[model samples]
Target: MKTYTYRHPEAIEHTGEVPVMDEQGQVILYSQRVYENYLKRTFDKMFDFRYFLKYEVLDSQREMLFTVKKISRRGKLWFEAVEVASKKKYIISYENWRIGLPTLFITDRKLKIQLEKEFEDWSNFLLDEVEIAKWKAEFSEELGEFHMTLQIHENSPIQQPEFFVGICQATLFVGA
Candidate 1:
């Protein structure tokens, strides 16, 4: 098994680059938040919170790996994961209002994403019933850092860093 980490950018500004690290604490991938429009950015500032955010993940070679976007559906937020090269979407997650938990929908694969603790909390989740990738959020901290032990499935097609990033952000930073 391998470990990876994601450190949120400095909060001096509302937006910055997030670094994805390997077990050795070396940067392997990076993510950046994107807004759909100036109006959305304005709303985020005016409300003093973020509602919708799109993250683009890039590898060390500067190759785009995936793009993940968080959107509002009904009364909850949902995530969309898209691969860069093939433009393929694999999985999407939406909240279960009855349990107040998020459930994943495997769009194009016969895989599953289950919460690590099974609805105890929203902070941690599993990739495929196993704890391959887990997120630990630190939103109230000084740097707003969120840590994770990410191990992308070697055989799964949904091995995008942005996918987990979106999941982590949705778990920690929900304002809508």
Candidate 2:
């Protein structure tokens, strides 16, 4: 049994379970554990999570670089990342976010598949704070598709109001 109490003037609060899928329609990593801590074993302190973009389906075939963004909080405050691929090697360009602030574009590899590491930050780097369980990288040319999942804490200190508390169970598919 579940009850939903809506909160107004702030973030939307609901008690319904929805598939936490990414832009590519994949479930957010560790989201299962985030809800019940049953099927998957994550941290006990984890609460809620969401997948923002999940949009990685081979932007292009040729060697190219895209300035990426953090699509999901994944139990962290801020995050940003990009998947780089070329004829040679593949790379994942990423950024750990501070907040939901306006992020700038990375312009070094404007239009090339950087063989080596190709990411640089300005001044304040805080990657150590974000504790990620998995950051997958896809390099299979035969697949022609890439998949990514992000998990963020729904009841962290940075979260406002913090409505992701109480008894929770992850949403599941039902057949009729």
Weakest lDDT window of 10 consecutive positions for candidate 1:
115-124
* Candidate 2 segments whose C-alpha is farther than 4 A from its true place: 1-134, 154-176
- The C-alpha TM-scores of every prediction are 0.71, 0.19
Cα lDDT tens digits for candidate 2, 1-176 = 11112111111112222233444544321111122323322331242323221112121221223222223345442223333432222222333333332222222233221111111221111123332111222223455422322233332221211111110111010000
* Whole-model lDDT, model 2: 0.23
Candidate 1 ranges beyond 4 A from true positions? 9-13, 73-76, 97-106, 116-128, 138-144, 151-162
Best by TM-score: 1
Cα lDDT computed for each candidate against the true fold: 0.59, 0.23
